[model samples]
Target chain A: MIATTTENDSAEHPAVPTAEADRPAQSEARRRRLPFSPWHLLLAPIAVLFAFPFVQMIMVSFMPSRDINRLPPRFIPTTVTLDGYRGLLERSDVLIWLTNTVIVSTVAVGSNVVLCSLAGYGFARLRFRGRNVSFLAILGTIMIPIQLLMIPTYVMFARLHLLNSLAALIVPWLATAFGVFLMRQFFLSVPRELEEAGLLDGASRLRILWHIVLPLARPSLMTLAVFTLVGSWNDLIWPVIAISDSNLFTLQIGLANFQGVRRTEWSLLMAGNVVAVLPLLVGFLVAQKHFLATMSSTGLKG
Target chain B: MARSATVAVPEDASTATGAGRRTQRRSEQLAGMAFVAPAVIVIVGLGIFPAAWATLLALQKWNGFSEPRFVGADNFERMSRDTDLVAAAWHTLLYTGLFMPVSVVGGLLLAAALNRRIRFMGLYRTAIFVPYVASAAVTGLLANFVFNPEVGVVNNVFRVLGLPQQGWLEDPSQAMVVLVIMSLWGQLGFVTVIYLAALQDVDTACLEAAEVDGASASQRFRHITVPQVAPATAFVVIWQTIQCIQLFDLVYTTTRGGPIGATTTLVYYLWEQAFRQLSFGYGSAIAWVLFVVTMVMTLVLVAIQRRRGGEQPA
Candidate 1:
């Protein structure tokens, strides 16, 4: 493929004749460009297009429901009010859902970081038999979508009487295959001699892993923690199916109440949206660097 | 390194410390197993077992409240003629088809634009990524209001622009369009970030060469940049396609398979049948179909990607 493509390209372009014509003038023009090139100016409107929906959501949150649907729509709210947030706080089950989300995300993130890191180390560094096979099995699980397992998962939790409890929400998410994969890649990058030195010094494997590997793997751990946190925080389907009781609702399921079959309380719903999204927005802001780093590094792996 | 050297001394009874060192190696193995056992148990118990059980349940006639009885593929057989399932499947594919191209192209275009240094890059990235962090239910609720036929901002914008004020979600023909648009809104940001990361890694020297050779910006982007980000593009496409296929939350919240069930995705239908109507067996069958469709699509996509990637120069 490579040889044929290269040959075809040479045959088509015949570089010698036109090469000199292209070079000098374009080279001179490139050197005089502004630091803020016109191409850079193209970014802002594109950014605006990307940012439009979010700004619209916030704008709509401030408007009265009556104005939300008006033709010749208003972008800026003339009658900006705290009505959505107030209605969300007083009438909706938004508070309970928020609490449930916090609890579920905390547990899921904490467990994932600890378990996945240890398992990742064991898979990456330890020379245990069947390790490759075990890792492959875990990798295989990534291909199966959660939709396929919901029914049986629902039944299992129901039989265990874990339905409608935070346990069901946190359990399935506690250890992700992606986390293990990410952590393993991270562990593989750390020098083997660090753990070996600790082991040679008569440190138990747990102590060696804890004292040596964990500290070295902090960045990846942070990445995994953020992934787990975001994943648990935004999860909807499992909570929807597993917990019918409103008391058990995550912010997502709770907000689903504003959506009645006939008429939706648009103002309250948007307000509820603000409440639900605020924490995540703040969380993303605080961890934006780590989040971006994690995403880019994840791309490198898979 | 010193400690490893000691451990690697191949059963040498040097200084008569062999017994203790052997005991230590055994304990290390035990500890390793102990560390990994919990995660293994969790995956087996929670992940694999349930998935396997779901496959079995699909073959049986089971509603959660009853003693699930074996029905021997009756559920699978019935799924063949289930009109709602068929409609939902068609809608899901339509939704995937509509959503993937828009988000991918939007992502690629935005990423290309933003790859150059721009003022307030962080702020723009943050604003774009807000939808990704928000729960889909919330995004859906917002969309429902924004796309509402009578009062939606979309209609207002159209009217203001002297354009036709078409029904966004109420009209059956255009209902899927609203969902597709909303899906794009939710997905575009994530795909942009992914592409942005890929674009950052493209060789600047190669791009400079293209520029020096009198390639226009579009030509440079097409010939030099796109091929470099092909893998990330493939990843974004496959991931978005899978998510689109199982799209239930937004449709559930906004449309509820509305305006004549035009937006009922297969997962939504499965949720309705299994959880809503308690036809667990039938829903399970539908769920399997989704699994098959997703897996097959992903495989085909990955293969095309591999071939494309292999053709690219290092």
Candidate 2:
């Protein structure tokens, strides 16, 4: 098939004198002087459809509870109020949930970065017995569904007397198989000569890895940190099962509870949802390029 | 230098450097273990061990509290006979069927549509991708409100159009459809971003050549673009299918498998069995089923990916 393709390409190249015109044609296709492509008209409504919910989420967050439940629903808020937030701050345990979420996410991200980098660096540069096998073991777990892990994990956590505490949440997210694989992939790409230079200078492997390999690993490290942070913060299932205490809830769990308690209280629920969503959005916008690259590359590997 | 010299074994220096090299080699081994310990421990303790333990419990008759009795597949036997299990399995399969294709197809189209440079490209991409980054539970919560029969936007739009207003989540008959659409809304962005990345990476030379050969845009896209992005399409399909199989968070927040168990799914049922009903053995059995299903699908995907990746470079 490849031979045929090459043959066809070779044959076709002579037929189009405009082969030299490829670059010009490509540039012409991308010429931004014309922004009014038929695409914009086709996709604008779809874009709006995708974004309108978020807009409505923001708008309804400020709408009074009464306004939300009104027979003829209002897309826009009749009156904006902080009562939704106020209700959370005053009535619910939003503060505890926020702090728990922060603590869990922070520790999870920190530990993932530190431990995954260590594991990655080890797998990449170290020549130790069973390193390949160990690496494969970690990689192998990436496909095991969380549902399968959930039941036994909960039982184990319960056995350890770790349930209802933040420990359960923090431990699992501390070093993910995927994160380790990601970091290992990144570490493998860093020039070995850089580390070898340090090795030749009588430096230890760990020292070289720290001083040489790690500096070049800034992008992967940040991506891993961001991914870990987003995952730990927004994760719902494990936390939902692990911690029954309302006071120990993460942001997502708190929002679920906020909705559960007042099923009709759309305003407060939306506000809670915004709060649950905003940090990751901030993180994503900040690391958009790295996020896009990492999400797709890692996604395909599975 | 010292280690290399030791390996080369200079006659006199060998004795001194041999000790040093052994120490260095030992240290390297220790360093590897030390470096890898935390991650390996976490993976094993939380990941591998749980799956193994779940498998063990799947065959036992443990309620998580009492002495685990050796049931020897009694739970699996009971699970097969369970009515809720059958219905939930069907519901999950139905959900996966409805959800995966729509997500993959819609995602590809959106990706193709947004593939070109246009005005506010970043804005559109960001808007489409927002729902994906947002928490599932949060979106599911928002969906509940959006699909609320009386006061929700969906039914209001239906009423405005003089269509029969469906009691979306509240109605058992319509709940799964509502849930599926909601799931699609949340997940569409993820698949789109994946495809958009894949689409951008699709070989442009072949596409241009096809176009230059007087191929229509649709034909060129169908013949050239589709094959180039086949790996990505396979990826999206597999990933989305796996996601659908383990569907839990959306169901948890939206309907909680309510209105006469219309929307009860596998994981939802597993949670009910293991956590709510305290039927840990039964839940473990279900977990094993989920584990096997997902692992098989993932392995198949990986195999396909490997073959395609090998063939493509040739």
Candidate 3:
């Protein structure tokens, strides 16, 4: 049923945008007809409820310890203070953790973009022995749960003496199967004629990829980079298992340890959370449309 | 040079002959393999190779410091008699049972509500989706503060509303419930965004035509909109189930498998067994069972989607 629906939908209505696109004229017409839709009454309250945790997290991070521990848990702090942030900075290796995370994420994004695109283009355009088999093998690996891989992976890392260092984090995120699959899908949708034209002009395959294909693939590359950055930055379980050194800990591992040791220090924990989450939040807000578009499009196809 | 070879072979095939074509084909093949080599090495080295090693590890007795000794099916036999594993399995089932439907259905309802042209639609969408981007560790930390028994905001609200206060994460009976709530808070936005994308692609021409034929709004929606988004619904369901089965991060950050091990999902249980207790073989056995269960569940879901209406699982 799924197969049929996908085939028929694509064949029948090709013009329908897969990603969210603004239709200002239709929205303007609807706005003139009904100044307020009844849906807003329901959505507005639900939005507030959904957004409450984030608001609370930020507010609680600024509140003094006593205010946070108050009986009637004040929504608005009577007085804002820098004590929580100051304590987090003094008590934890949060700055070092932040730097480590940035390094890991930056390396991950760069590697995934380069490696996945090369493999994706190879699978999409070239005629080679075992291309389909190899691609399918890589895709099948995506379904293998990380739980299954960890025990033996840990053993392997132990044998190689790659444990308790950043390489343990960096190696696994170098090139993901999901990244390759996503890039291949994007490449397949691109017009073959574009590459053929380059071929006609005597461009090498690598030259064509760099000059013709990569420019057109900017959106998919950004999507891949965003996903890799977020995944590596937020990764906790693996880092917790692999790196026990406090100085080498990423932001997530540090925050988890911080929470365990200082359970009663609500302000400190909240401040750590805000610090860990702010960079991503800022990135998402700045590229809201691209972020939303990439997520929705990839979700539907994958 | 490969570039010169291409340049020498002009558009007219009559000028080049079979040798030129063969040379070009060989070069292309070489280029393809060169492009794919790095990815293959990483994926096989890290992903596939480790998986094969895990299968072997499941049959061995290892404690990290000693050499692994092959023990055949002893590890698998141990699983049959393990009570903690049974509890963890049941907890995983309970989590999947509750989380999969509620999030998917809630997403559909919310997507429908937000589908129409409205002011501040982008703002509403952003507010909902913000939680999905937050790390599970952070969400778990925030959940502890918000749901704390004594000084939590939820309890304070309960007191104001004249309701009895109750222990949340500290109470074994209520800890799983709290975990589920936190998970939904973080995941519902993802499901909603996918559904919203599907809803936008529903054929508006068909809906307008139905309206001209005097069909009621609810009738058109039930018959038309529901069928159109079936594939996305299937995708969301399967994806959410996989996520629920792999529940670890939130449990680690919030309960640490909890007050009485009440919230110990399978992954957390395996992690503790291997990492904490140094029973690598038994942990690998649990991991294998989990992998098989996930594969079966995915197959079953895909089969159901096929039978429903030939809707392809995205």
Candidate 4:
């Protein structure tokens, strides 16, 4: 790579000073000539179109209940207040819901990371009979619509006498096939020399994995952790089916119930929406770099 | 001659070492199996068994309180005869068909637009992706307000334009439309980001080469960009179709499959039968059909992907 770089450098920019020889002259020149290309200008309308709903949601969250409900909707709040927050905090079960959401998401994400990584590593690195078959079968699960699993899962939970429990909310999601696939892809990219070095030192595969592989795989693991955390935190349907007790209801489910129970309580509902969605937004914002990288890498083909 | 003689002696010793290495490899395989056991156990015990049992339950008669009676194919036959189940299946297909094209195509456009290095690109990306990360329940709750028909922001916008106000969720025709639109809104971000990533990795040299060869921008994009991103498109289409077919939360919250079961997709219908009506056997039958439909759709998608792969340049 270094040898080719020198060749390309000499070929492309002979007249440039040696100190500036390595820069991508073409791209840099294009940047200097016209930084704001017409292509870049197309982003404005598209961004606004995509962003309108969120801006509306944020603005509406602060408005007085009556103003929010008006036919000619108030684009901006005439009187901004924390009344919605206060109402939601004091009057609703938002706190309990928030706690439940935290517990379910934490348990689910924690279990998913450990289990999926182990499975992923085994699938990626280990030699075993039926390895391909097992992996394929797991991948097959991804094709099956999750809705098909819902009724059966609910019935099974009911039979297990685990209905309306937090366990119902957390247990089934502990081993996701997608997470395994991601980890397997990541593990495949890791060099075998590191593992061989550990093995030569009389470290068992498990010990080597724990000490060397896990630490090396921190970024991928963090990506998986964030995926699990965000997914579990935002999941809405399973909790609705599984947990009937209001106290056990996660934030999402509780907010739905809150809306149904008090349709006109815009202040409470908006406040609840803000509270429920805040953690997820905060979580994503903090991990935005990892999140974006993971999104692009996993989803796109090129 | 000296080197050859020395190599001949070490060959035997090296063969012994190779044999020992093979033995070590076997033991490592056993240890690897040990490491993978927890995941396999969980998948088999919790995931596979439940799915298999559910398939069997479709053939039985159980209404939660009653002992599950072996009712062999009665549920299936009943499902075939039921108009509601038929309507529900059709609705599901309709929903999936509508959702897939709109979301995937819209996502493609948005992703292509966003992939450009524009001002505040990070903020734009986040703004678009926000809905995807928000809980369906929260979005559904907000949708209720936004599309309330009487005092909804949608109607309010219409009113501002001096147009007729309509109750989006209450009207059957409008209800389904609202559900589809809301689904498109939430799903676009996911598909767009995926496509954006794919777009970034497109070989700029290839594109520039095409441009230099006097290829129009449209021709280059169509012939080069689209084909290169085919795999991403396929991935998005298949997954999006699966997700679309499983549209439950919005339907459940916004319409409850109502204004007269006009929005009754398969899952909602299954939920209604199993949970609300306590008709477990029949509901399981519907659930099985849904599973089969999804499996078939997935297989078809796989077949398409395989065909595409076969045609790709080596």
Candidate 5:
């Protein structure tokens, strides 16, 4: 292993070596007690403001449809019913829609993890002809507003009979430029010495990438997976345009149909909305650390 | 990482009698190509290929099922006369102009708050960040319920406070305002996170030095902290501007470019033309208009930055 684990050019966030856990006996318990501030009061309310929506959504979803549409809306549910969630799961195509969404997002996350990690390694650490040009070409596409490209992409997909299929939904997401960029940024932080040592020991390039670099890349891979999952799961516009078969609709498109089912049925729609947003909410909670790091490190496309 | 795999070829192997080095070099090249091939192919096919094709398709007249006929500059010419496209364009600019500043300044203020020595910081962070994770489509849907004229929480609060309940999402002028509020609420978390990170990296040593000079907390923040996060602020502005320009899903779910198209942004207009109207060529033209508008705005922002004494942080 290299003596220095940090890369010189990885300027985004320099790695700081953690201080020794066992301090000398004379200096034991030296950590200071921080002073208090009244900022907690200001912050608590804003936090409540941001988090109250999900609570409201959950509360309303359980209330009977009749209760939600009354003249004065009730903030507290007097009687919670499983009718909304039950009607959704049993009476509608919600199950199939959820299944399709999971399948699409899973495939998207898996492929993006594999492909973006590989391409990211290539761009970040390898030297090949046309490397700069290729990277630039990919990066330049980020600024091309999706609107400018959607019309022709739809036409092309239509011509190829890819419409109404899961392939259409999965194609554009298979390897995003953003994913590649994110991976590259992470890979750049990996010191080159580890690979050189592997090379000296007669490890092949792919073997080195797989055995050494990939293990070190788990954090970034997880971040990318979560991002891709959230994106593909929450996607709405493309699915609306590409998939016409109700059987193939992702959660967003399928959930949107709730609006049409009952124009102003707040309870049914809120239940569906909660169901649609639940996975991501859970996913974020599960991967909160990585999500925070990823957001801070990169500028995600909204 | 093994960049030498293809650097030493068979010829070098023969001359140097260095079998290990030669294999490694050749292997590196082949492996690099194999590693990147899948993603590059997809990017080229779905991304670069369509980008080029769109420019060509914009010059023709064809629906999804039909044969293309050359229309020369007809679509672009027609765009100049499209009132809906024009209105959408104006609304998009308004959205960007208003939303960009609020998201940036509000985020900076929130980040400044979060950066303090406060208790339950993680709880605050988690709660504040919840909205940002929800998809705009979901946000828009939930917001519709929250801002419903009769039963919405806003009206309910207005009633509790002994005030008039305004027509929120229903009225044309109020519709855009509600949409902007939704956009701000959802985006506030993201921008705050970015600013908080930048705030943490704001050279605490400099602030400590300023404290030695007897500067007040606000003064140190005004001088050291704000100036330190200037680069991040610039980035947030540009990034948020790009996002504002692509405002579609939320509008798609809530407004659908309605209330007489008051809330129609450029993207919504583009979708309507291509998908709803099946006017692919005209839609492509409108898309170009959006692309151009984004470019001009970005350029203007950059130019203003250049003129404002570009004092980049080290």
Candidate 6:
């Protein structure tokens, strides 16, 4: 099942090996010969500590409210119930919030992939006046702290009457400078011969990009999509400021408000958190290798 | 089409193809502009345009609604006298001072432990990294429950051990400490992953040579491993510091900048002033200060890294 999923995920860039393929056979042999390492003594406890909150979140989500409210709270509940999930669904706007978050993230990912790739390819492969200058100016925006822009952005959105709507959340995330930068880097590394061959075949630049470049650029596109999705999904402060309407609140804003109003509702809060986090968690688990590889490589490069 | 086909022929037809090539070049330039138009619009309209507007807003006094009256330097003057800003700055400094080193070093140690040929290395790595994949709001929600003063898990453990219970997030003095812990929990995974990748890229030959000699394990780690990961360390530190400076989501969700303002970091303070208090002009002033501080710190860190002969962070 894992192998099949890995294959499906990397279907775009078949020429590049998956993380599993990168593991050497000698490591498997070595693992068998030395099953124990002293690092485990230190690592085991730390891993448990790291994983404890997740375990607790899951366990407490199912715990009865009485059990949660009891003094000296129980790590493992004696009784399990669906009351938390039920309450979250019936009483709160968690479902609406989840849907809104999904819509925002999906739009963010889609726009970033389509737009950043085009811009990145333009900067990487095409010859044009002021291309270098424009790219540098865009890159410089990355250093301008988002905090510095928020107040004015809020005012601008208000003037444009875009505030209190999903557009406020979606517009800022449509195309990021980092996404453009990452895609440009990836396109620069791609061998030019493929595109050159296409040009010789009388293909327009757009046709070449669509047929020859984007397919090879899938890994980078995936990386950009994942980052943008995570960022938009988890965004809080901006939504908290821009969207005052309860009906349009994203999951983070909804959950933050839920916690504020129902501080004592531990089970409900846990279930809300679980719902907010589970999609990304499942995604990470499915493409763990790709996620790790992308993160590390991107961190090193940018 | 004929021009493309003739391009495969010899340069003897260069004069006829030159005009075609020039047109092709012009078309390519137009295509480039067209391709980049959407991204450039968004970047300039949202990112750069708002930034310039922020500079102007910083110079004017507006409560976000009134007609902007030009008040030169008044907002910045207010910032100098704003005690809340000072307190928030101190808290931000304190958070960075504690959070940066702890997370970075913890990440290094964790990465070193996993950088071996062992069973279930993937599992260990995944476990350590899962928190980073979770949203900060979710993490803050969990932290609130786990650190609740009366009925939370930590207090429960304290009771189980017959130790005195202490107020965590609700405590004025300990709120920042709890905030740091929560931030570290979510960020250490990212730092570890970077360090782990760097560790894997370390020269195995050098380590083997050191082992062949009389270098002890700790000595080898210090001499070989530490220096090898310096660039990664620089990257991690700078990243963590930026994150620490922009520390708002966790604070907003958890403490709302505090039990008596103990955990109010710079970004959180700016948010409160601008959004909550409707002090947009003063907030923009604070925002400019933050931008300046971020740039200076980044440059200084990069300079230090370069002086040590480490590669600049990309």
lDDT winner: 3
**lDDT for position A116 in model 5:** 93
Query: Which sequence of candidate numbers ranks them by lDDT, best first?
Result: 3, 6, 2, 5, 1, 4
TM-score of 6: 0.91
Interface RMSD of 6: 6.4
Whole-model lDDT values for every prediction = 0.74, 0.77, 0.82, 0.73, 0.77, 0.81
Task: Write candidate 2's Cα lDDT for A26-65 as tens digits.
Answer: 5467654655666687788888988887888889889887
Q: Could you tell me every candidate's TM-score relative to the true structure? A: 0.87, 0.90, 0.90, 0.86, 0.89, 0.91
Steric clash pairs (candidate 1): A69-B151, A72-B156
Q: Tell me the TM-score of chain B in each candidate.
A: 0.90, 0.89, 0.89, 0.87, 0.89, 0.91
lDDT per residue for candidate 2 within B208-230, as digits (tens), equals 77777778778877877777888
What is candidate 5's CA lDDT for residue A6?
21
Per-residue lDDT tens digits for candidate 5, residues A1-302, read 01121232112222111111112333233433335445666888998888878889899889986677776777788798987788777656888888999889988998899889888988987776667888888887877878888888888888898999989998888988888888888889999988877766666666777899999988888878877887889888889888899999887888776676666767777788887899888877776776676676565432
Give Cα distance to truth, residue A270, candidate 1, Å: 2.1
* Candidate achieving higher lDDT, 1 or 2: 2
lDDT (Cα) of model 1: 0.74
Clashing pairs in 6: none
Global lDDT for candidate 4?
Answer: 0.73
Write the residue-wise lDDT of candidate 1 on A176-203 in tens digits. 8888888888888988777766655666
TM-score of the A chain in model 4? 0.81
lDDT digits (tens) for residues B25-79 of candidate 4: 6765665565556566556556666677778788998887779899999999998
lDDT tens per residue, model 6, B1-314:
12123212221111227787877777777777767778877887788889999999899888977798889999989989989999999999999988988998888888777665445665677788888777878988988988988777788888889999889998998888888888888888888878866765666667767767768668878888898889898889888788889999999899988788898899999998888889888889899989988889999999998888644333
- DockQ ranking, best first: 6, 3, 2, 5, 1, 4
Query: DockQ for the candidate 4 complex?
Result: 0.30
Model 6 chain A worst lDDT window (10 residues): A13-22
Give interface RMSD, per candidate.
8.5, 7.5, 5.9, 8.8, 6.5, 6.4
If candidate 4 were superposed on the true structure by all CA atoms, what would the RMSD be? Answer: 8.7
DockQ of each: 0.31, 0.40, 0.41, 0.30, 0.37, 0.41
